[model samples]
Target: MENRWFAYLIPPFIVTLLLVAGSQFVFIQNSFYQDLGLGRTGTDLTLVNYIKFFTDSFYLKTFWITIKVSAIAALLTLFLGFPIAYVVARMKSRLAMFLLAGIVVSTFVTIVIKVFGLIIIFSADGVINKTLLNLGLIERAYSIIGTQEGVVIGLMHFTIGFSVLLLYSVVVTVPPSLEYAAQIHGASRLRVYQRVIIPLCAPGFVVGGLMIFNMCMGAFTSAALLGGGRVLTLPVLVQRTVMMEVKYSTAASIAFVLLVSVILINLFSLIAIRRLRSARLVVA
Candidate 1:
């Protein structure tokens, strides 16, 4: 019975593998062709699209901007989420469950709605600007729309709940007795967190950071809405290349480059983290 139940998983797994791998192969294969405009691709395979992506300053800048925003957003999300997760995880009251449920629901909310809420709050005549103006914090109303800062904020809003959930799970895994022991040994509260909690959660942090970074990298609705068409990330560039420019081949090449870059970065990051852990073990 158990064997028969396990067998049910294989068909869906194969179907998923075929759908995902098959589509990716088809899409990436188109990158080798040249764009002839009007949604048409040249019959002859060429490296022109890739070459153009590398040579063009605009594309390079967009790629860097994407990385920068994603990295910043991921780091910020981790920082902001850690404290909330810690507090919630340590809570003895039922409120903790409520908080977690709230976070989960908010996280799953549609990005379009979230972006619009951000816009409302950050608009020139919105609550934030009005409060700042009233408090004499600024002479004029400033906007984050069309700015890199806005994009970063959008990304953070998108990923903060996930970060909290990830860190919360990590925090819970750390035995409370360890924190008590550290405190009993004359360690301060801060010291307990620094020496006991953080060290144990390092692996979780790396994994969570990378997951958030990957999400930010591929995020389209948040970037598009927050950026206001000024700040162009790789995903946005790919969309424009395909939809506006009608250059399918170039878009495919850009998409391929983005995909490869994310995979390589993640691979290198994990390898580097492993080396660091090994070094620490050797030192100990």
Candidate 2:
């Protein structure tokens, strides 16, 4: 059975493997892995760029910042999405359809559009500033633009939708009888919702959180636009290296690191999901 499954996976896997091979061809050829346009002159096999990535305070700081921002974004998505999922899951009307439509629309919207929209709203002379100034909130508008706040708000544009969809799907699988039993057993509404519901939905939350964290960790568009280019995420840094600077080998190395990190996160999440399932079965 496992062999049959492997056979089914082979075709697409082979094609993707070939593509990855092509991508690495240049890196392997150019011992030092510089830009394509730059012809190798003399020295090769140097790992200077990677050492710089590690030793340089600038790059290290940006790496830490990316981790911090992505973590916060994932947590915010969790807290903000839980209620919407519960409400929409329980609802049986056109209003639920409308909320689902909003989630669907949010997923379909382009990141660039959301970033530009936020830019206009939070710009120095934009609506937020104008409204605040008019209301005498302050002599100057508080700068939300080009900061972590801007990045978080922009990240939430997509992540909130992801959270809602994932959580909603998980909630649908939960047996309604459990909630009824809890209520009949004298549990309060809040207790039934929290104690009974949340524990059961842990797997979906783990999956969704890891996915959101991974996406935000490598985010380029939102971080660049909202952080005003000051927020240097791994993807944007990789882009700058590949596109602007033309450092292929170093970029390849960091890209490898990012891919490995994602694989490990997913692997750990799978283990956690399995453990939760096992524990639930034992309890049953």
Candidate 3:
């Protein structure tokens, strides 16, 4: 019966492999072909697209900006989410349940709506600037729109709830007795958390950070909306290349580069996490 159940999974697995891997294979092939203007592409394979990506300064800058923004956003989300998750996971109150529900509900909202909401909040005369003005923080209205800062802020908003939820489950699983024992040894609150909780929560950090970084790397809606044509993430550039410039071959190359970069980064993160886990086990 178990063998039969495994056999039942084979058909879906093969279909998924074909649909996902097959499309990526096509994209990789398209990237090798030369772009002949007017929606035409040459049949012969060439390294022109890949060479342009490496040699051109504009493409290089966009790639750097994407990586920088994603890294910063993921790190910030991890820091901000940890405390919220830690608090909520420990509390048995109705308020804790309410907050968890709110986080879960926020995740269900459409990305378009969320991006639109961010635009309104960050506009020239928006609440942030208005509040700052009232508090005498600035002489004029400040708008983060059309800047990398705005884009990062928007990306963080999208990822924070997810980070919180991911970390919450991990935090709850930590044995309370372990924490109590540390305190009984006369360790201060900060010391106990630093020495005990943080190390154990490393897995959650890796998982949550990977998800946020990956999401930010390929994000298009926030880049298009908050970037205001000023920010140039790979995803935004890919869309413009395909839709406006009609450069399918070039776009495919950019996408393939993005895919490879994300995969490589995640692999590195996994390796580092494994090493850290091993070191921690040895110390314990």
Candidate 4:
């Protein structure tokens, strides 16, 4: 069975690799060419587009902003998700199980609908702003839409359900014996989680964080709908450049940069996690 497993996996893996590599090859070719207007591009190989992406401050700023926003969203999702995941994982109550089911259902809703719903909720005249105004939290309707804060908030909403689900699965895998042992050794409930559960669930946290970060990095709808041109992310910029300006080369350039950034960041995070895990093992 073990020997046959590779044979089963190899064919699909090759096919997937070919499809992904083929599309990326096209992007690489497109990135080298110069846009000649009207969805046309020159075949002449040049580094002009790549140079422009690095040299221009606006493009650089957008790249950094996208990274920053993604990081913020990832962190916020983790912060808000872990507690719910822990609760769901450890819960014996029917109500808690029902709530977990609701959270799982939330992830299945179409992201387009979710983005539109978020837009309505974050709009200046939305229920939240109206409520805040009525409560004297502010003088008038505070606009969350068309801002980075709005984009991050929407991303948190988008990611938290998935994060919770992932973390819940991870937490469930951890044997209750370890936690019970910690408690038997005079550790308080908080201490058990802090010293045992959290450390044991480190891999889940990393997986959830990376998933959320990657989603936010390439996310278009939230930035487009909530950003309202005020928070231009790399994906939104790529869309505008291709559709509005017909700059295929530039758009490809932006996309290629984003791809590289995501890959490098993922690599860095994986390496850091491995190092941390190794150090933790050494300490133990």
**Top TM-score prediction, candidate number:** 1
Shift of residue 108 alpha carbon in model 1, Å: 0.5
Clashes of each: 0, 0, 0, 0
Worst 10 residues of 2 by lDDT: 33-42
Best by lDDT: 1
Tens digits of lDDT, candidate 4, 62-126: 99999999999999999899988887888877887798889878887877899888778756789
Ten-residue stretch with the least lDDT total in model 3: 275-284
Would you list the clashing residue pairs of candidate 1? Answer: none
Off by over 4 Å in 3: 1-18, 281-284
lDDT of 1 by residue, 115-148 (tens): 9999999999999999999999999999999999
Misplaced by over 4 Å in model 1 are 1-15, 281-284
Error of 4 at 62 (Å): 0.5
- Which candidate do you rate higher for TM-score, 1 or 3? 1
Shift of residue 74 alpha carbon in model 3, Å: 0.2
Q: Candidate 1 overall Cα lDDT vs. reference?
A: 0.94
Off by over 4 Å in 2: 1-16, 24-47, 268-284
Ranking by lDDT: 1, 3, 4, 2
Pairs of colliding residues, candidate 3: none
Per-residue CA lDDT of candidate 2, range 1-284, in tens? 88988898999988988898866765554535433433322355666556777798977887777778888998898889988998899897889989999888978799898778878888779998999899998797776657887788778775788889889998998888999999999999989867878778876777789889888887788888787777677777777767876666667656665666668867987786788678773122
| Candidate with better lDDT, 2 vs 3 | 3
